[model samples]
Target: DTAVSQTPKYLVTQMGNDKSIKCEQNLGHDTMYWYKQDSKKFLKIMFSYNNKELIINETVPNRFSPKSPDKAHLNLHINSLELGDSAVYFCASSQDGKDYNIQYFGAGTRLSVL
Candidate 1:
């Protein structure tokens, strides 16, 4: 079975709408991350959480937030969506919040703003 999974593989919403992408991991990892891939294919880390505690928040816009209600789940919530926010969002997990650890990635959620 896949270790990481994301719901709503494809999301289409208006510019002012709010939406969320849900992610869950069954690998028993303590750390989870949210990453955004822009149109240019540049990937940036948005947020990181360990054991449901947020540990890293990168330079993402305030409209974008990561919420982890438990160690097994981490979700991304976007407020007042915009065209510039359209991109591929990925959910990843690792044993711990370390770069050296093997990270498992979800199939990714593609968001489109129209």
Candidate 2:
């Protein structure tokens, strides 16, 4: 089984709409993160969670939020989505929220806002 999995592998929507991407990890990891990959393929960290506590929240718009109800799950919610929000969102997790720790990533959710 995949260590990390994200639902709605492909999402195509219009602007000004709200949407969410669900993510889950089965690796029993204590740290989870949300990342966004733009058209140029640069991955940026959006949010990070360790043992259900928010940490390392990057400079993202208020429209974006990471909801972590538990240690194994961290979902991303985007409100009033804009055209610029179109990109691939990835969910990742590691054994701990420590530097140099190897993180396992999901296939990614491709979001297209037309």
Candidate 3:
């Protein structure tokens, strides 16, 4: 079984549309995160959720939201998506209170906005 899984592996949409990506992890981790990879392949964290609490990254725009319905799931929602929002979104999970710094990542959802 996949440790982390994301739905809609590929998404192509026009500008000004709204979309959501769902994520789930079976690792029983306490910490979950959402990451975005730009066209240049620069990956950056957009949000982190620990035990169902939200922790947004300062640089992430308000349009981008992370929602955790439970410890095993984290979802990403984007409103009025723009061209710049086109990127690969990754969901990750790790054990909380650990110094291991290791996170398991999902296959990623590639969103393309035209």
Candidate 4:
């Protein structure tokens, strides 16, 4: 079984559309995160959830929202998607409040906006 999984491994949409990606993990982790990898291959954290409580990165725009229905799931929603939103999104899970915990990443969802 996959430790982390993301649905709709590919997403193609026009600007101003709304899209969502779902993720789930079975590793019994308490924290889950959403990361965006730009074309330049820079990966940055968009949002994080610990036990269903949200902790968003300040640099992330409000257009991105992360919802964690439970400790093992984290979903990302993008409203009014822009061309700049076209990137690979990754879902990850790790133990909560651990500085050295290793995060397991799911296969990324590639989003293309035109």
Indicate which candidate wins on TM-score.
2
Candidates in order, TM-scores: namely: 0.95, 0.96, 0.95, 0.94
Per-residue lDDT over 10-92 for candidate 1, one digit per residue giving the tens place of the 0 to 100 score? 99999999999999999999999999999899988899999999999998889998899999999999999999999999999
Each candidate's lDDT (Cα)?
0.93, 0.94, 0.92, 0.91
> lDDT tens digits, residues 23-109, model 3?
999999999999998888898988999999986575878998888999999999999999988899999999987859588999999
**For residues 33-109, what per-residue lDDT tens digits would candidate 2 score against the true structure?**
99999999999999999998998889999999899999989999999999999999999999864657798999999
Backbone clashes in each candidate structure, one number apiece? 0, 0, 0, 0
Q: Candidate 1: deviation at residue 14, Å?
A: 0.5
RMSD of 2: 1.4
User: RMSDs, each prediction?
Assistant: 1.5, 1.4, 1.1, 1.3
Question: Which residues of candidate 2, in runs, are more than 4 Å off?
Answer: 97-99
Model 4 steric clash pairs: none
Q: After aligning candidate 1 to the native by TM-score, how far in Å is the CA of 9 from where it should be?
A: 0.2
